[model samples]
Target chain A: MSDGDQMTPSRPVRLATRTVAISVFLLLIAGALVTSTGSGLAVPDWPLSYGKLMPPMVGGILYEHGHRMIAATVATMVGLQILVLGFRRTDRTTFRLGLAAFGAILAQAVLGGLTVLFLLPPAISSAHAGLAQIVFALTATIALRTSLFWSRFTDAAPRAAVEHGLRTRASRLALWAAGATYVQILLGAIVRHTGAGLAIPDWPLSFGKVVPTGAEWATDGVLAHFLHRTFAWAVAALVVAAALALRKLDAIPGLRRLSTLWLGLVALQVALGATSVWTGKAVWATSAHLAVGGLLWIAGVLAAVLLARAATLSPAPAAAEVGEPQEAAA
Target chain B: MRTDFRSDASKSMKTFPASRPLWGALVPLAFLIAACSPNAPEAPKAPAGPAGKLGTAVVAGRVTLEGAPPLNTRVTMATDPFCNGQHPGETELPEVAVGPDGGLENVLLRVTEGVSGVYAAPAEAKTLDQKGCAYSPRVLAIMTGQPLEIVSSDATIHNVHAAAKENRAFNLGMPAPGTRYTRTFEKPEIVPFRCDVHPWMRAFVAVLPHPFFAVTAADGRFEIRDLPAGTYTVEAWHEKLPRQTFTLTLADGETATHDVAFPSVPSA
Candidate 1:
């Protein structure tokens, strides 16, 4: 009845949420494929491929059309998820989040079509990509919230008063890490859409220095590339700080493991980012880099949510007389 | 304190319902693997048409400049030191090449109208070379469905960016010398290719439904052979001059000769 009371979501609702999350992940990968292979304009006409529903699948058309197909599938899955959540789940937060995801996916589809119809304008394409990540995050959040682990963990555990400050700090830090990572990913989208990936022409060092020099500093492409790299370092630092904070808390059973995982993912992401520049944006390296980036963001958000749950369950001093020992048993 | 909480949380976590296995995760992976795999079916080839019969009529002609040819500015390759070093002194880009007596080279000539039959594109590929940081045969013509082989001959990287309005645009990177990339345009368009790395390197290609287009040579001569007898409008285009078009009628077993001249303007 209360926020601390665990409400078990129906199996169907959980399954649908998980499905939407996976679908969103796949859609993100498809989007990455389109950008990586330079196949955004492979299918010039949208909604219909070359004036037909099914175009001759070849060359860039495969990536473009396949992206459209994956998008459509994800849209359908989101629609279904929203229906299940609305009918079965009484909790308004998850229901509304599902609906919001639906709206985002619809907007994303429109943006995708407009991007093709308008000939891959940088703004529209970048927005489409940005929205995909947001939608993926939303779906992942819903999936995590609906999971049985989340429900039981929040309901059964009564955090000790001693752990309250640490949990709050960890939660806020994780939230900051997630927000910073999203901003970095958006910058990455700009760098990619503007063809700024090769602006620096060298990695680890921009134009053989920590910062761009001379004409490289003046060019927009080079500036964007440099910002992306700079922001990456900032994000890496934030991830490390968040990981350390979570490790110290160690109150949540799985939070420590998730933090370690974030460290590994961030390291892998940095390697992939460097390899992307070194390999001249090789398709595989760049695509993997994007996928890992998305995963890292997801990990950050999940850690924040779990820690916030722990913070909420921290025993209140005034409620100490209200069955504290039974709550501890839980 | 942490161990006490951990034991309690693990016990409660065990009581929690089992999350559903991620079966749906495999669907996207399958789709992605299938999309990226090389074993997918190839695009259908363009339909084959009857080959040209022997002894077909030919349209042969010369393109010339009527006045002093437009002076082409020198290409500055200072952005990439490698390209700049290739040219010892000032390197002038050959935009308008005019010989003695006003012979104009690099004029693109196409049969604009009156061709009706479907002409099969030759299987042999036409190559456009990137050497010395410039496109060889700056102006080229090909029939629709003909494969274009873009070969990079310079050590520096060059991206062949085809800016086509009617057809799909492609930007491909050739990172090493001797790298050959092939592309085919399905629609008729006058596509311009530029190197984004070296902004000054430019090339134009005209793709037509029929194989009746030709680019004028150094002596300003171009011959469109195997054109069936017909009254057609031939259009001549020069990069620096206005397009000129004229109607011509070719009779059976007759060789027609026509000269198209472009009025030249002084360099800016």
Candidate 2:
């Protein structure tokens, strides 16, 4: 039912969409690097770096300007996807999806500009970061939908007797996980932006306690960091639940592999977060923490889409492997 | 990387980049023009500071703190090897520097009002140096249109960012040791300067229309000499304490000794 029979998949559009997704992810990391290095105000001008197209990349300028450059790259790739998807309106769903993504990217750019112009106010900066994840999830979903895997899965779905029910459960769980990851990302942004990442300074312990005390809560740094840690556990629980649910169905090796990847990313993301605070907010650790967070959001989204698609597709177990030469082929 | 992210932003900040070649050429030009627009305020003209030797009337003072001295915390400088190498041992920041005699260091005293006239800026330039990864003379005052030359003495990079409110803000990177850049403020405001590389490094500059301001010395003494006698409103500022202001009417050749004890009026 989710399938778009009108879509004539083009390899170039899919490749471009994936490229945009990857670039946006990198741009997010670059942005994290700028914040980690305290380079947001280094250039001190909007839509430009130091009154020039390219100021000498040195010091904070390197991180700040580098981020702008990557954002531009992401914009260009998104533009390319937009052109191909809307050409002759060949695929209405994909084209509309691309247009929506294009709109989000445009808004993302505005938020980015406003973040700089406002001298990095925490609220606006955090919003800028939050929207970036949305843009990433959108482009990443676009990539997933345009892929050969998506085409194959949708065409040959519901191959197992128990798959529909299991996928329905997994799809719901994955959606919740994605939402949790997004919330975690927002919390993490606050922690980073508010400089609360090291308020506790000790891992597996909050100033030597497993839980925050009343006195600790009085300190804003402690509160933000505590909330980030607490939300992370919730996110991990949902992701693991979804992964296990997918595994329970024992159908679609690809979905199983994606779930495993999500589980691995969750574990790695937590470690990077700890590494960030433990290492005194090292650029690499904090940036990777952000990068991994972006990936988790996208992966959760992909899992949700694929599982939901698998659950709703027409049952075609006999023709799944051999292909429907008579019906689908024509 | 962890060191970079581990800042206690709750303590000091409520916080939180790209692009092109030919496209960059045009876009940044537009921004540059907007920055250079005439909407910015102009500096007061003619005799803004004290006329040389015009008045013997002097406002001398000691700024003292009533409360316990601030706990100067040790800043983590491990992120930059250059900064770390500069301080081999534990170093506490001069957040509240009080001499043994209780004279507070780094309190800025300026004639805020009742002294009117366009003050000509001196030709000699004021210097703001970044040495040993610290800003020299943490608090200073300058007349509007007076050039402030910013220089870096550390081999590492230091971006001098002026957190200006009444004037156009600027952020410029001084990458190498002895890299010098000059700028002037066109408005009267208290501008806070900071280094992005070393968050603990801070300096404050009071850009005044007149040269009637002085930062307290190490012994908590501040003397703004040769003031043209007149009624004036003097304000004293300390980073850790509330700013205190006093009203005085000094006659020609009169030296007024004023003492400021903080936990200022409002706080008291």
Give per-model TM-scores.
Answer: 0.59, 0.67
Give the per-residue lDDT digits (tens) of candidate 2, residues A22-130.
8888888889899988888766555655444676665566788788888877877787788876663445666677788778877777677666654666897899899
Question: Which candidate tops DockQ?
Answer: 2
Instruction: Rate residue B42 of model 2 by lDDT.
Output: 43
The segments of candidate 1 whose C-alpha lies over 4 angstroms from its true place after superposition are A1-6, A160-162, A315-330, B1-268
lDDT of 2 by residue, B1-268 (tens): 0001111222242212224442453344444433543222244344444444447889898988776676776766765677788886677888788889888999999988877656678878898999988999898888888988788778876767787888877566564676676678878888999986577788998898777889999999999877887898999988768789999999999999999987622221
Chain A TM-scores, per candidate, are 0.92, 0.91
How high a TM-score does candidate 2 get?
A: 0.67
Question: Candidate 1's residue-wise lDDT over A1-330, tens digit each?
Answer: 122354788888788899889889988888898889777755544454543445545445567778888887788889888888767743677777888998898878767766654556688888987898889989998998888887777755564333555776778889999999999998999999989989988888888888776777787798888889999999999999999898986656777789899999999999999999999899999999999999999999888878776766764445465435655554
Estimate candidate 2's alpha-carbon lDDT, on a 0 to 1 scale.
0.76
lDDT of 1 by residue, B126-212 (tens): 989999889997998887788887888888766566778777765554545766666777788889987645656889998888888
TM-score of chain B of each: 0.80, 0.79
Candidate 2: give its CA RMSD in angstroms. 10.2
